[model samples]
Target: MNKLIKKKIKMKKLFSLLWLLCVCLTMYAQATKLTVDCQNPGWLSNKITYGDQMTVKDLTVTGYINDTDIKFLCALIRDRALSGGRLNLENTHIVGSISILDDCMSNGWNCLNGDGHLASLYLPKSLKKISSAIGNISVDSLYFSPQKIHAVSSESFYGGDNKKYLKHLFLGENIDSIPKYSFIDCENLTSIHLGKKMHYIGEAAFYASTNLKHLNWNEFTSSLDYIGPKAFLNTQWKPDTILIGDKIENFDVSSFKYKDGCHVFLGKKVQQISNASQWWSSGIQNIFLHSKSIVPPHISIRYDELHYFTAYIPHGSLNAYKSDDHWGKMNLIEDITHVDSIRIFPTNIVLGHLGETASLSAKVYPEDASIKEVEWMSTKNDVCIITSKGTITATGYGECSVIAKSKDGGLQAICRVAVKESRPLTAITLDIHSLQLEKGEQRQLKAILTPENPDDSNVIWSRSNDNIEVSNTGIVKAKNEGKVWVYAKSTDGAIGDSCKVEVITHVKGLHIEPASLTFKKLGDSFKLRAVLDPANATDTTITWSCATTDVCNVLEDGTVTAVGEGLAVILAYSNDGHYPSTCIVKVDTSTDINIQTIDYPKETQIYNIEGKQLTKLQKGVNIVRIRKGQVRKVIIR
Candidate 1:
């Protein structure tokens, strides 16, 4: 019984050992799923293997990774180690050729064979070039953003047995050229996006891409310079619509071979067609040319190729095309025309007076139409006469119709012209009612007439005195110092208006009387006078102001009054802006001073500071003055 227990214990120890071994193996398998970061240069030489429970599941390459590292990765793919893996090299600066060998059997691994699963590549703008043999790898999807790639090499996508697996191709901007056989034999390529910067499509670039349904050649702008022969041969992309942009200037022969039943819109800048033997041959229906495009001399579509095709030319250029050497041979060329109409300008006209002339114009619809000239005639010549060139002249006082008829069709438009009689002279008035002038001064006056009339309302200007001379057009000249009356009278009737003019010599300087004055207390007033140098200066208007209004104040007529016990300056400025004068007024607060009544008459009235009449004067100050006369100051202490 003890021997039997020892056997059972040994068996239990064996079972525990096996359990620990299994757990270690599981941990080893889990740890073998590695991620090789190509950003670390150390990993570039590291051989990543698969199929022995050691798998490199993911590889990340940052922009710092160079082409050598990419080449190493491609070599690993060729050696069948990184098969069925994911390569994320987005925004990496990997450039140069990407070569993948077609002889997968040389690797001695089934993963590199025809049924081998290649790594999915995510490429972005940093990559510049893709090697021609990259298509040898059996990749299901290729995310390519070749914005920095200027040209794609020939046979760049020349996949051997794996050509049928490429599903999507994304071409980025800045790729201008696609060499011959770039995407040759990519039979399973279903979708492709071409960038706008592409200008040249080489021979057989997309040949035998059977699953591709449509190719948007319309994105090719004027930068599209050339298209090689058989560029799209045998492709399933028989697009129903093909729009060529305004920048494309040339198209080679057989460029769009096997493309049929499409409506092609040609751009304005397409000036040359090298050969048109096989373009739009099968089932083209319509071809619309830009309004400014001129067909080249070498471009000619055979009758059999375009039997049902119609060429739509510019509105006014159809005849030119039909008369040309090559374009004239096009049997279905037609002009784009619109419905015709007519319009007359200045819909309403008013003649100022009899015998006055005015001009009228007409515009025809479809400005470039064959018949753009119009015939102008007056409906009533007795009222107003109109020339054939649309010039109208008033004959008598009435209304008439100026009719414009299109020469091509019977469409006509009319403008109504009214000829009214001139208004009779009612009254005449000058722009200014009164005028004051200095010697050698001149002024231009305008005359306003009541019941304004453009004709028959002439005014005659005259002067009553010779001191100032009036011109025929109401210009007044001040010759000597005196007053005169300038009159503007209507010629028809003697009705008129006159302006009183005062002309005097110019003032050289200003003189202030009593240049200095003294005031004993507040409420003291003084009358100041400003005299022109010549004494007869017409500009006697003066403006007065006190330097300090808190101490003294002045009126518009040079009347100064002391308000407080302080000295102040009273200034007088002439209306002509020159010859300024000032008066110095001194005030004393030492004594109880009384206002002087000498400057005022006995009939002068007495009032408070607020200009209210008072039966008795206040104890401080009073304003005593006559109505419309000088003011007097008084202090009642």
Candidate 2:
């Protein structure tokens, strides 16, 4: 019985051991199960070295991660092989670039022989930055579309002929600088877009990138310093153009290289050019030096199609300008146009002050080989001032002609002038002995001007504070309140005229007749009628209005029409001939006519009519007058 019991215990122990082994094997297999999620595990605690050979295809990783996880994840990819045998990172992202650096350098990454498949990468928005430790990768195109990225490190992408396979590289907005040698040997790169917020670019950042055709540098940077010598040498291209910031002061040699033709634009602030001659000898055809005060060393101008010269040389350096040997050999030079002449005239100048303002003129010319900009300068204060186009304005008292000379060499001209002073008529007046009138009376303003200059043309009349307007026909109207000052302005620059009158605002009554009327979009001629209060309608004018002048238009005489829509505000003003009274008239677009009797009689008649009319008709029978779309009546006794 004791032996049998011991046997049973041993059997149970063996069974338990077998069960444990099965569980261990199951757990190992579960962990090793490969899928798209684990393809780019970004935050593993351990990293696989470049020695690891792995490959995978079509991975999707979306989330926050740390550096260690990314390193190991990359190693795992290098150790595996994908279907049809090509390593692929379809879509992936990491908080750093170290893992990618190790994976790219694995087993002498060679895309040329197709041994390792490291070609394209897509970074999502979750990545915060790309690490500087990124060393080598055979990937041809790298796309980084994250919300932010810190930098692209030096030597991050290095390879040989396969380097040309990297045709496109996208940097995100958060990248502030491009580290030196980041894309040092990317010979196949055709376009590189630096982020807008980037302020610093390290030396040789794109050295030996021969295939790079277009580079769009940051626009707002103020201190962008590093661009190395021959940095973009031996690139295959057409006669492409290059543009640098207007504020940059220092530049490197051959920062921009082209195949057929090239040009360099020195910043406006660059005051001098010391070295950098080899770049000029390459494909560069033009050198635009935009400096207010600087001259670069002699340039070798060999290209035949280059003829445009633009430079801002200093004003006094005419003798220092000499064309280069090659530039002097050109057979044809474009003709230079002469600058405009100066002119001066008197505005409100007292006739006795002709010496202060006399007509003057001068001509300017293009500068010599130096290409200095020409400007007009005045040496004497209040004596005169000259504009670039040579328009002179007199300040004080004197006669002087404007002077002009080339900024570099050649070209000059001047205009002749004469000055004279004679006493001119300053004021004109009407000597009224006295206005003959009883109490409570008014009169229109009338006057003549004494010749101060006898040439001024704008003359206007006023009463107390209001204007008593007069016409070119000498017809005057008392348009406002109080005493009147009939002043005349001269448009031809002559003496003005003035007169005075006392106004009585408290008139018994005043009215401008024809309170309402209609017209076409053009106009209708009608007599301006005025009626005084207390049955004394006399010495009055009917002024018209459309209220808003910019809109509909109306004449000074009472004639109006519909210009736009809604309602047109017409005003009828009685000037007393002293002070005027105003009345508002509402004009409706609808047509109106009146058929009434002048006397009690009878007959039937019709006639087309125009102009002012007065008639009376019998109550039953009458002759109706009809004009353009309107009807009226005439009565017969």
Q: Which candidate number has the best lDDT?
A: 1
lDDT of each: 0.67, 0.46
Deviation from native of the Cα of residue 396 in model 2, angstroms? 18
Write out the backbone clash pairs for model 1.
222-247, 222-248, 261-283
lDDT of 1: 0.67
Candidate 1: 10-residue stretch with minimal lDDT: 103-112
What lDDT score goes with residue 210 in model 1?
68
Assess candidate 1 and give its TM-score to the true structure: 0.43
Candidate 1's C-alpha runs over 4 A off are 1-39, 44-60, 66-86, 94-120, 133-135, 157-165, 257-260, 271-297, 300-308, 316-637
Clashes of 2: 52
Can you write out model 1's per-residue Cα lDDT over 237-311, one digit (the tens) per residue?
766555666666665535664343455666666666554345435444544333345443346545444334456
- Shift of residue 220 alpha carbon in model 2, Å: 8.3
